[model samples]
Target: MVSLREREAELANETQTLQTAADLFDASVSEAANLGQSSASVLVALQGRVDAAPLATAEASRLNLLQVAAAAQPVSIPTYQRASIDEKDLVDVGKAIDGVRLARESLPPLVTDVRDARSTVTAALTSFRGELSNLGSAIESEAAKAVTINDSASQSFRAAVTDAAARVKAAQQAGGDGLAEMPVYAASLDALRTENARILALEQAERDAAPTTPRNPGSGSNTGGGTNSGGGSNTGGGNQGGSPDTGTNPDPAPSQPAPDPDPEPVPDPTESEEPPIIIDPEPAPSGTVPGATS
Candidate 1:
């Protein structure tokens, strides 16, 4: 009974920091969610612009507009890159949250130094805080690096879009039906935009599943990646996929975490003279994220 009380006492103390970390972690997750959306939006637009630039360039060349064709040169599309935030940290958080709960309810070994209870979590939290601080920079760096070809595809995308439009207008001004292919060009551009909307973002059904990691003797993992990119596979087809800290008598048993709401389309796409209609991608009708326990 004495040892049980002592173990509880230690966990109770760790609970305070857990609460604090969870709040910060959740906030970071929100910000990251927003950033991820923005990144996806930009990349999708860039891809459309890069792919569609050729139509404009071709029209310009056929119309004998050397400058317009030159300006509309295609910006190379890149293999999409994302900030590689470690998935382990997320899993650690989830496990720590779960393990602590289990420790309190189920008896861990009697002599277990509850101090070790928070070690994995403490380390993970420390690592995560450091990574979170650099998250924006990391994201920016990845975006910048991936788009470097052709002098930054976003800038290049915008210029291409603008020049492409210019060529179309120029054709109108010259009284020569430019390329006699306006319909085909417009149709193609529309198709590309539609495809971009369809292909880029996967349906996310993220759940904060019950902590799956068992509590071990000396260490614990606290994060289930907290709904980050690596939490689970957001399958192309559609569907996929919190805690508390308090010292003293422990808060009532924590309810298993709820599913994270699917991500919405985030903002700030590169606009063009005739920008593609970038719709806020609607949520996928239905799908599952792999790795969700329930």
Candidate 2:
């Protein structure tokens, strides 16, 4: 037969143990719920990736077509020649060819990147599914433990009450007035009721915080930039400047007109009229003297 005080003590201890177990169960449930949510988020991301795969593939195909077009057609030379192209047509052709070659060379890596993205999404989905399954199992097990603890605590509490009641009845029978001692039993009953209420409150809090189904997982953990379907980065090479020779020439500048040559001077007309006049000769002193100097 347990004394009234001893029985009260045992009940208090049992209640404390129950409270501790309930707290641990609550913590476990929270962790499981978080895990479940994370798993769900991973799944959603994975699905998004899977859906995006085709778009990435299409983009890669488009790039391939661009490469082929670049290769087949001359970039600097048009079907019809233009004034701009005429001066440096050969140089323009070389630059255009180089540009097309660079574009074509870049396509292979882009395609590979897209393929890698598809693989990552698939792997993430599989991992998320596994984690969700594990979390579900853990939550179920913790719930079962909580149930068992609750049952055991209830049984212990009831037995403690009965034993305390029996002890109070015996004490009353051995004394003068049972009513006079009733206050003692009532006080014990009140204490027991208070302890039970505290236990109930703790249990309620646990249940309120428990995880439910249809959990929502958040976003992905990766902090990197956006990748194409092949898992390659979207950014490409830097821009090179225009041709230096075309940019620098000073003469015959497109903005200025060409200089005119100097005009020829007019001929004098008076020279033709004055050229016919002649002088008269002196008389011949002698045929020989006429031509001789005196």
Candidate 3:
């Protein structure tokens, strides 16, 4: 009887556990149904919103406006060229950030190329600056060298002229002293002097050897003819009664005077009327003797 009672109690406990499990199951089913209804309502509301909104129409309008602008402007889209960037866009931090982000994303290679070009330009500028600085120094150095060369040339020219003058003076003195071993210039001067002296001596000898003519034998005048047979000689001595010998001397030494002839008997003034004969000697010919005249 004890064993049968223990079995009945275990059966009742098992029935209660089963009833509790069924209640938990029914509550979970109801919660699931409520969740499904709420989800369906949210989905219906979202569908109504989508159906009523003008998003597509507005987007189409925007596209149409863009096309009209493109037709009016006649500009190509997705072009690399830009006319201008707005000041507001550049100054606004948000816009500037967005622009930079877009640029980085879309044109990474262009950005890299711009950076590289800027670096190259900077390097070129630096190199050009250095070259200009070096050019200044080079020009200064070359100018100094030119000055040195000019001074050297001037000094050299002066020295050369001085030496040449000294040599010329020495040559002149050597020639004046009649040195046999003188320079060519000195010898030439000596020869010229000798030739001049020889010419002078020959001229003097010719003048000395020339014959001089006697003047009229009766007149004191040396150039004019006179009726008097006696005239002055070339030496300014008293004239002689005859012509002189043809020699270098125009007049010989004075000799004894000739005796006067006897006077003729006076003719009757009415019977003789002829004039007295006056004898005047002619000028002697060259290299010939002159005859005596009475």
lDDT of each: 0.38, 0.40, 0.38
C-alpha TM-score for every candidate: 0.18, 0.22, 0.18
Backbone atom clashes (below 3 Å) for every candidate: 25, 7, 5
What lDDT does candidate 3 reach at residue 185? 25
The model with the greater lDDT, 1 or 2, is 2
Instruction: For residue 276, give model 3's deviation from the true position in Å.
Output: 65
List pairs with backbone clashes in candidate 3.
216-231, 217-230, 217-231, 218-230, 218-231
Mind giving the per-residue lDDT tens digits that candidate 1 earns over 1-294?
233335446666545444444454444444433433333332333333333344333322322322222222121211211233443576644544455456544333321323242333334333432332233233333333333433322344434334444454455456433323233333434443444444333222123443344344223233333342344644442123322223222223457999999999776566455757767855644565554555
Candidate with the larger TM-score of 2 and 3? 2
Ranking by lDDT: 2, 3, 1
Per-residue CA lDDT of model 2 for 1-294, tens digit only, reads: 333334335444544444444444334334333433433333333222223443244333333333332333111211211223332466755554454444445444544443443344334333443333333233233334433444424654544444444543454346421223334333433445556678888989999998644312222222224332333333322112321323222233145777898889766875684567788887776556665775
Q: What is the lDDT of residue 118 in candidate 3?
A: 38
Using lDDT as the measure, which candidate wins? 2
